[model samples]
Target: MTKEIWLNLPVKDVEASKAFFTAIGFTPKPDQSAPGERACFQAGKSIIMLFPDATLKQFNGGLGVNDTSTTSQMMISFDAETKEEIDELADKVKKAGGNVFSEPSEVQGWMYGFAFADLDGHRWNGLYMDFSKMK
Candidate 1:
């Protein structure tokens, strides 16, 4: 049973990446390598590590890590407590320089959410589920 998770991502500019996420309510964590080359940000309790291209290249067996600015490798999600929260996050995503590709809306009658992409074009979503609507 895993208790924690960490997502490591590559960024073209660490400072810019940090500012973008922090603008959207994420907090920076102190424990990270290389001040200008790496950063650690927290989304709820999960840790997301941002590393420069040079550092990330050393980790992926020394080759080929595609940039999400062109193609997506994954879409990370966040859990929202209510429908309003989902909508709020969607706004923040755009205001923080991310794109809200899918506006917040009801889905399958029980879930409400929106999809967006970060400055680097990494996709993400914030979803709210109503258990009462489950069959």
Candidate 2:
């Protein structure tokens, strides 16, 4: 069984990427820092790696960067403890120079969520589930 997992993503700027993740409550793993290659951040059990675009190109055999304006491969989701927390995070992301894609909204009468994009245009969704309202 796998004990842990890490998600690797490519970005144009490492410092900006780090700042964005920090604002979203991810902590950097100091041991993983290196020169001109990769940076790692941890959010609870999830690990997100930000690699430079050139490194990512080399790693994937020279694949071109995705056109984020037209398509997104995935949106990272974080679970919030409450609806207020979700809203608070949305505000923080914006204040940290990110963009909020959605205001908090109810879903299926049970969950509330919002969406934001990081400095590098990576989209993230934060959700709060009301389990007590589940049928």
Candidate 3:
């Protein structure tokens, strides 16, 4: 069985990606830092592997990169403990040079959430579930 999971993503600039993730509260692992290859960032138990554009191309057998400006392959979601935490994370995302893709809003009157795009144009969703109302 696998003990850990990793999300591999393509990035234009490794340094900038590292900085952006760091500013948004992720810690990069020094061991994964390498030249023209990859950088690993940890978000709680999740590991995000950021690969250079060229390296990622090679890893994908030279497939053309996706147009992240208009489309996304996935949306990484983070669960917040409270609505306040969701708001705070949105602020943090903006402070880290990211843009809020969607404003915080209620979901079916059962949850609150917001979406943001990282410096590399990856979409992330921050959500807070109202468990009290679920009962």
TM-score of every prediction relative to native: 0.90, 0.91, 0.88
Task: For residues 56-131, write the lDDT of model 3, one tens digit per residue.
Answer: 8888899977778988999998788889888888888898899997988898788899999888898999899987
Query: Candidate 1: misplaced stretches above 4 Å?
Result: none
lDDT of 2: 0.84
TM-score of 3: 0.88
**Candidate 3, residue 107: CA error in Å?**
1.5
Off by over 4 Å in 2: none
- Residue 57 Cα positional deviation in candidate 2, in Å, after optimal superposition: 1.9
Pairs that collide in candidate 1 are none
Could you arrange the candidates by TM-score from highest to lowest? 2, 1, 3
Candidate 1, 41: how far from true, in Å? Answer: 1.3
| lDDT tens per residue, model 2, 6-107 | 888888888778877787677988789664567888877888889998888888888987767777989988798899998888888988998898888998
**Please, what is the whole-model Cα lDDT of each candidate in the order they appear?**
0.84, 0.84, 0.85
